[model samples]
Target chain A: MQASNAMAALALAVGASLALAAGSAGAAPPALDEQLDGAAPVISVPWNVDAAGTAAQAETLLAPTAWAEWSNVLGIDLRPGGSGMEFTSNPDYGTFWCSNGSSPAYAYARMHLPHGSTIRFFRMWGQDLSASGDVMAKLRETCLPNVGPAATPTVTDLATLQSSGSSGSFTVTSSPDHVVDNHQCAYVAYVQFPSCDATTSLRKLRVQYER
Target chain B: MTRTPFIAAVFACAFLSSASDAADFPNRDFRVITGVDGKPARSDDSYSYASGNYRCTNASTRATPHVVRYPFNLPEGTSVRYVSVYGRRTSDATPITLRLRQVCQSQSASDPTSTVLATRTPAGNADGYFISAMEFSPSPNTLDCRAWVEASFDISTTACDASKAWIQRVLLETEPSDRIFRGTFSVNVDYTLP
Candidate 1:
């Protein structure tokens, strides 16, 4: 009986050890916030002077551009403006529009990241023609995996800023759950008058990330 | 008695280990296209295409093309087994063709070389929105696969032309105030990771 009891205890020990091994193997790496001793700049997307150009121009400037700060992960090509709008640049900010008495317009910027990287937060500054008391604006993120049907896209609402009743500036910061899968690319869309007959514009936008 | 209990413990341990490994595989979603306002002249009085919608063309047009391409990539050791495409059109009976191709390294994502793997023409949903799916079982599975989609629709003046038919993304909008139509295209892929 004593020998049998010893064998049972040994089996229990073996099982427990195996469980621990499996647990460690499957555990996710430490999050970006936990990895740094102090705040360190990992990735930055500046939609300012450098990114300030016509959508047609942006298509060339943004494509195959390397994020020098990160391990040189190549950003994907940016398409020209969407169907309804035109990209315009100004001294203070870059903007796109459907103009007054014009049809609704849409525009977006997209990028590809290195596998397993995550976006911690995103920041943007913009406003709609609602200051003219005419329209409103909305921002959303569409994330897609590397492999799948092109027809289906995952859309997430980032923010919705009503017309300030004047051309005032609005800024927004994203929450942490906005993760990008290691196997997918990310698309950030700035929509003006989504339903049509409204006008909006964006002055500045930035995205911060970690490897 | 001792042998039986020991064997059971070993089996339990094995099962747990396999489960943990399977949990590491990642699943993701992507929007290849969003909704855009249909062509102005194609707008029908009954169905307002002025809002953000996509219009189909008889042949490729300067405004709305008959064929559109979207590019995507897969991680090493991962294979896609199934794809689900969701779209909505102004007309219910329009027919659309979807083709999957292997992208050559030399070609851009927007332009792929001639290596077509699968093609299907799903029947449109008379109800306006349709969800079509395709399953794939490649003979020799490959890792690090780069792929793209070539989607086209028939152009019948009376049936599926600019005036009668349009396509849009399938999105649930909570706010009616938003007017911009981000062209909508969604594809759900079932993948297995090594």
Candidate 2:
């Protein structure tokens, strides 16, 4: 009964929010009224968040120690398409630093953390989900593994981004362009349950914006 | 025996009523699951059919700023009454300040020479090192609507800087008020058009 009620309440909240968003459609910014008369803004962008074999090999998966900090950073609803964007549209280039997990803990950034401790593919930008961005990517194993002891998962920043160039910069004055970040957690069957931890993590991703 | 039809009628009525209750707009935002594959020639990918109020947040190392031009298809003459900016930090981090600006695009952000529609500096917002405006000018054809945030953290104060930015996903609950901007942990609003 509680679960059903919770689900119903959640449904209502989403409905309300969407209704709020589902207004007259294409409500142009007041400042643009004087500029754009009647034309659709172009929307096009590319993404890049591929992690090349650098995940940590672990036996169990527990929330990262820095989960609070990570969650705080990702939980706050920034902007719709994305928040605090670090890329320059004109230059279409930028970089960010991602270091290893401060501790052996992890978090599901408002988004889903991959299953089996894997950080799988995650969307870096989207009007669809900027609201829930901190959830770890590809983590379906919600219940922490039960073993003699649980090992905290760790994350390490493998590289420094020089530029985040979009694949195809189709100017989008209305929509959003996003990049995905990949984090991988290794699972050790031989080690036993509650031993899952992050194996490889890609800290920063870069995308280009262009014609 | 003869009451079977009556029961069926009642059941149908109940179902319809329940559906109506669920069909409301603010009731539940439509969440269309989307995915991207190789290309047109490719077979394309398979995203599960999802029914959620919102989409998942994009993961990034830095707190990225994303601005989406809204209402992709509003009939011509769709004059906007107001515009607002809503934000919230996904993490447990407290006080993730957000700054909303309404500056002229043609005007220079570098030179600070453009005319601002409604600067949040005087309002509940601040004029950070990096602040852009949401394109709401009279011209609908102009590709101008935009928003930005200073995302880096202050080494000394340990606060989020609006000047620095990232390319992560951002969610919008509503819009922002003309006089009010910058949310603590999270924010939502309807917007100011006048």
Candidate 3:
């Protein structure tokens, strides 16, 4: 009975979210050149946590201790009798990394949202291994104005996970502008690994946007 | 008697849906890349953006051969035919290699494997930047749904100096299809019966 009720609730939540996305007022939908009357399109970008751009930094942070755990950076235990990406401090002291600190871990996927589509939401599937640790995920947009020799780009946090649920999505409260403006400004989606502890594995990060 | 009719109905609905989906879309041009969409592969790579143009500055010997990748965000199974990149080099002799590659990553989060589908070397035009394009034969070359697509910029041969290599845009002309799905899908089915 609980399983059935949970499934039904999930379906309802999805339906509500879609309706909300479809109703958001913003730019006109791009012309579907081939399908004159087809439904608006949606683009989904999925990234593995290992795809994070700051992986080089993460490896540095994890350091030789991580090396002793896993043979490779991907956290695979190729070495004989080696544990796979597990970390347990000898003194059991608390450490906050990944999503915090001066360099947060972020995996970037190029955004090609049709010129006028609206960003809907972001979803992540991962596990927080430590009982006191947090595995937070958020979607960030970094945009650079197209009319400069080189200038500081803008970064905006579009959406963030509301809870520790295995699978969760939060609506974007910021502007729904999903245009790929080559002449004005360009945008890229960066899925952030805001907070994570040892043994935390992020299987996937997905961004959904509608045309 | 009821089970047989129910199975027949399911099949009929699926067939109709497939037929209608095919009829709705016709082959059309789809552009997925612009110069501004590219991101530097390495943190140390030097890049500049200006008026829809992306410039890779080979300023440091340590940062020579900058690689900027423009990832494709089109639907899975989309067919691509023509690809063009417009750009100019500060020095007419600067060399750049543009590659169309399909990259596949296994579920184990291991190293992503890639295959070069096409390669185009843009020629330096005396009159600033011109379009360098390649048309694939047996056209409508379908993209792999299980892999990611990207246009890789390789400026390995370019001189390592303050000189700049600029790219205005990268365009892909694709045929519109009914398969509008996005992202990679991994499905496992069990056939063992109880």
Judging by DockQ against the true structure, name the best candidate. 2
* Interface RMSD for candidates 1 onward, in order: 18.0, 18.2, 19.4
In order, the first chain's TM-score in every candidate is 0.45, 0.18, 0.39
lDDT of 2 by residue, A78-190 (tens): 21112221112110111111112232223222221122222211112211111212212221222233444676645332211111222211111111122223233321100
Candidate 3 per-residue C-alpha lDDT over A58-170 given as tens digits, one digit per residue, 9 for 90 to 100:
10011111001000011110011111212221001111123222322444333333344455435343444444334554455666766547878777766665224232211
lDDT for residue A145 in candidate 1, whole number 0-100: 59
What RMSD does each model have against the real structure? 16.2, 21.2, 20.0
Clashing pairs in 3: A99-A194, B28-B176
lDDT of 1 by residue, A1-211 (tens): 9999999999999887665543321132212211233333433232221112211111111112111111100001112245333333221112333433334544454433344544544434444435344233334556675665775777776554343433333434343434555455444545444323324454433344444
Model 1 chain A weakest 10-residue run by lDDT: A68-77
Worst 10 residues of 2 chain A by lDDT: A187-196
Misplaced by over 4 Å in model 3 are A1-101, A105-136, A139-190, A193-204, A208-211, B1-27, B76-80, B90-92, B106-111, B128-130, B134-164, B177-194
Instruction: Give per-residue CA lDDT, model 3, range B1-194, as digits (tens).
Output: 87999999999999989988745434454454567666554444567788877777655444245566554423223355566677765435456767665443322232334456677776655555567676543322111112122233344544433234677887666453222211111111001100
lDDT of 1: 0.37
Candidate DockQ values, in order, are 0.02, 0.03, 0.02
Model 1 TM-score (2 dp)? 0.32
